[model samples]
Target: MLLEIDAQSQTPIYQQICNQLIIGIATNKLQPGEILPSVRQMADEIGVNMMTVSKAYTLLKNDGYILTDRRNGTMVAAKQSLDPPFQARFSRELELLLAEASIHQISETMIQEKIKQIYQKFE
Candidate 1:
């Protein structure tokens, strides 16, 4: 996995890792059963602290985006759930995003086009 981190970005290091892994899963760049690097190895590879990588992995596991087994190591999850509680949270986040875009005067057509382009990637 090649995860790019922007130290200057407002997002924290762990979140950048989490976001990239999620994107990898969404884009089919990472498949179910694909093993990921160990915390120490990933830390060295990305020049981040081991704890940072561990935090990211833990969050991903909790979010159902990845799994870890002692024998096989960490790997992507087979599927992500869309439970009702999670759906509500997802909707709220998306609504906030749209509101921000609207505040910036982003046209609805542009947002729809971008949404379609991104949604097609998961197909």
Candidate 2:
């Protein structure tokens, strides 16, 4: 897995690590069941304290993005359908998005068109 850290950013080091790892997983750059580097190894490679990497790993495990076992170390968790709390949180985020879209008089069609245009460009 590849990670880039901006030491100058306002975000905390641990949060940056966590966010990058989450994005990597979501993008399929880091596959499910793939083992992650150990905290001490990552900390040494990233030139950060072991506590920082440990914090990020703990947060990821707590959030169900990773699984940890004494023998297996840490690996990405299998993707599961969203639970009730996750579904509710997603709905809340969508509601906020719709509200913002309405503020600009944006319609569903406009959103779809923009998405298609961006998708084609990426392709």
Candidate 3:
């Protein structure tokens, strides 16, 4: 997976790495059980500190997006079905977004179109 880092962005480098990896998984760019680059290698490639890459990997592992093993290294985990609490949180976030769009006078069609555009990025 090709991860692009924006050093100047407000988001931290580790978070950017995690976000991109998540997108890669969502878009099928990174297949389940595929091995990711080693932390040292990824850090060298991305021009970031090893600790930054390690932090990203740790976050992914903690979130169950990736798994690390001594023999196998790191690989993407199978996608898990969202449970009730997660579904509720997703719904709440979506409602907030829709509410903000409505306050801005964005039409339903326009909002849907925007969502489609964002979703297409994952594909």
Highest TM-score: which candidate?
1
lDDT of each: 0.94, 0.88, 0.93
Please, what are the lDDT tens digits per residue for candidate 2 over residues 51-78?
9999999999988999999899999998
User: What TM-score does candidate 2 reach?
Assistant: 0.75
- Clash numbers, per candidate: 0, 0, 0
How much is the lDDT of residue 65 in candidate 1?
A: 91
Candidate 2 lDDT at 1 equals: 75
- Per-residue lDDT of 1-123 in model 3, one digit per residue for the tens? 678999899999999999999989998899999999999999999999999999999989988899999999999999878889778989999999999989999999998898999999866
| Ten-residue region with minimum lDDT total, candidate 2 | 114-123
Candidate 1 error regions (>4 Å)? none
Pairs with steric clashes in candidate 3: none
As for candidate 2, its clashing pairs are: none
Question: 79, model 1: CA deviation in Å?
Answer: 1.7
- TM-scores for every predicted model: 0.95, 0.75, 0.85
